[model samples]
Target: MRELLYQINEHLKTVTFIIIRDNNDKSEAISDYNIITLKFDDIIKSVEELKLDFQRYEDSASKLAELIPRAEKPFKNEVDELKSLSIYNSNLFAHYYSNTLCNNAFNERKIVNNSIFHLITFRSIVNKSKSNIYSLVNCIKDTLFANWSFKNQGEDNPLCIEFNKPIRYYRIGNRNEEYIVADAALFNFFFDFKKALNKEQDEDIINCSSDDNDSDGSYTSYDVSRESSYENNHCKQIECQTFLFIPRKRKKRAKNDPCKDPVKTIQCYFRSKTHKLHIQFPNNNEPEQELKKSKKKFYKKIKNKVEEYKIEKQSTICPEMKKLLDEIENDINKEFENIKYKYENMN
Candidate 1:
């Protein structure tokens, strides 16, 4: 998957016009909006260079790993022999990987930590591209919904048509604004991971600063104890954190109401869970038993899918790195809950 993502990134960097339009329209003229220039040969060379560089990093990291007891050595060459390949100058890759390896020479963990570092860095890259991805998706959506009536383009276009619905106002940062709810949800998702990473990085910096100060024998026993306690608690949290359970919030309905419907209740539940479902419980009525049934059904469905997915993709991820990912995912889930609560209350 990482290799595939790297390939996709390279492809995106090279011949980079991605659009959704009429298949019959063969006008391949370059547009200012969606165009990037790079030869396929250059892309192959870049990948080859990356592979070579990856091996070098692996070897370097492995040698450094030998310095720490119980540290696993990094994976060796995964590169294929490719002739006449030139190195691509990528400061982002160099800077990130270099810092990941050299950030702390005294790190007790290196290879596994490096993998986790790479995973987070990958996520950061993908998060950065979310806006472009969103735009692409919107373009595809618009094309799919297009009436293609050039006679009255704006009037005929399905995308230009707007419908009224319940308004939900939410605050993001200092801005009190109204926008697509999904955009707000994605913003929260992106913000949570970034915020947690920033917080952790800041904490590490503070700890290093404190360690430097303490080397001069200015550290108190209480300060050491407090830091140790915090570290212990954090370790425990990571060890115990595997699954996150987020409860669904529902409005209270009157008891024994015949108007309550199970089908609409299930629909609403799924709709709230994901925007993919366009189910609407317009009556806003559901029996308590049916709601419970819906909750159980939802839980079971997710559990099965998660179990299958875990088994299929589990081998690539290191267990130690998986723990770190789980911790971050749990944090994101909590952040989502908080955002949901605030949004609901505002509505």
Candidate 2:
């Protein structure tokens, strides 16, 4: 599970770099917008295919579980693998779909001009984590649902339950504004369940070792408790340290003040959470880290190119264009209100 989490995290980092660089480059951004539209369509079709696959697997597991009697030990490994795979595919679908939404929102002229892009950027991060949690929870629910057939005597039917719903809305900084975010409830549940599962497995191992007939291996409860406690404590520390910094209006700063002169205002508006695990578990020989560093450099170049384009565009503005720009700005303000209205309705 940890490895899977790491893989998803790494994927998100790559996706972030791609998105930031692509959005920052005028020509590239246009090209990417086109490509993403096509890719998103394909991804939607792929999601349909995955849903079918999940349904088929669920049916097969249900049948198998029903055939296995209550007294008989079922093939746990096969069933578990199927459940996990279904979850992984579901998560992949969610991630790709969310990414498509993000790309579309970012590319939308109205959305970008209205400054809704800021909220979309934050939501993208939340979605990245939430998708994984949703996937795991759905998988567990499906597995348990299938197991229900085996538990009921002479029952050929399986009962399935809906997975826990995702969480949304998180307070940004110390502000009253609540940012629409993905829920982490599923992930928290999975974390606790995993810990309990590990504890049970450890007890089974100890019992096996102490038994005269069994000779599997020996593992002390002390060792298990120490490792589990360490992990729990580490996670707690990370959560305590994690914070989102949202920039609020300074004492004398006006609500309509533009963040043009000092970039500090822009910096203050953005927030990021610090993860101590990354520093503690640094990979000294990671080729991946080098690749990431290179990606960052490339993104920096792209950003510069975009800034140059913006300057050129500004300089080329004639009287007619200035009037048009003013009209567009007015339209943007109205459109922003509409977007906010829609968002509020969603809430």
Candidate 3:
């Protein structure tokens, strides 16, 4: 997966047009409008086009897994191999084996290996691209939605577009203003749970650890207790931690009312009972269920996916992958410098 992302990053660097460099001096300054029209505009479009490729890669790889036999063949491997070659023809068998099938007669293993390979490859590409693209998008939003005072009545107020939604007003640093954030993100930026819990002076929290299972993993395990007498599974308890359940807001509806016709597929961040941020996204096609049960189930689903992603990120970062990524980024930086020089010289 890292290799595939490295490949995609290298490919993007070769495009030679997305680079933006500082133009601080008046003589060297590129017009903001030009920068927007070129860099920002092209980046947004490129991400969309790249998204198609990512999806295609995943689908193609999934199909590739199908080339392996649907079920395991426990008989003589030579007989199965010979039959496949004779029936599918030597050239076709060679192609299929090279692309998908392998000496492992275990169908499930073969399918899992191929499918996972492709899934990780495409996911890594999109994951890397989305982060960079969203950063640019946020910059555009901040610039277009910064705090503005209506001095001249005729002056236009800046506008911010929240994804596919209509243009809306935003006040910089204003928390009271209702804002929409629909990030198709994989994980939550864990809002410091301790800070959220420790905001007030009156509340107290307890922290604890023991001899088994939790030697290294240390996080703000919320003070989920009303009294100091509360003891954890492990007997020890330390002080100063506190938290309360933060119920997710929902529209007022009848107890029997079908889960408000499932909202659009969007990833949102919410404060959890433990005071940490968690991502939530409901599968739109899922059948409606009782509100509380349905929501709790969906929240767990999102949390599990985020945990898997973090594990993948950690395990996939080998020395070779790191070297490859460094090389690719170096090439990208070089291309960026070349483009910057060319653009400035031309201007």
Residue lDDT tens for model 1, 1-347: 00000011222333322221233322331244323344444533443334324434433444443433332333221111111113322422233234334433233333334445476574454333333333433332343223222212232222211111122333546874332111211222122223233344342211211223323212111111112224443333211221111122222333432113222333333334322111222222222213333344444543454455568764323454345344433443454355445544644
**Top candidate by TM-score:** 2
Q: For model 1, where is the 10-residue window of minimal lDDT?
A: 1-10
Better of 2 and 3 by lDDT: 2
Candidate 1 to truth, TM: 0.18
What are the Cα lDDT values of the candidates?
0.31, 0.31, 0.29
Clash total of candidate 1? 0
Better of 1 and 3 by TM-score: 1
Which stretches of model 1 miss by more than 4 angstroms? 1-35, 38-139, 142-316
- Candidate 3, position 280, lDDT: 20
Judged by lDDT against the true structure, how good is candidate 1?
A: 0.31
Q: What is the lDDT of candidate 2?
A: 0.31
Candidate 2, superposed: residue stretches over 4 Å from native: 1-43, 64-75, 84-167, 173-347
The list of candidate 3 runs beyond 4 A from truth reads 1-140, 143-314
Inter-residue clash pairs, candidate 2: 167-183
What ranking of all candidate models by TM-score puts the best one first? Answer: 2, 1, 3
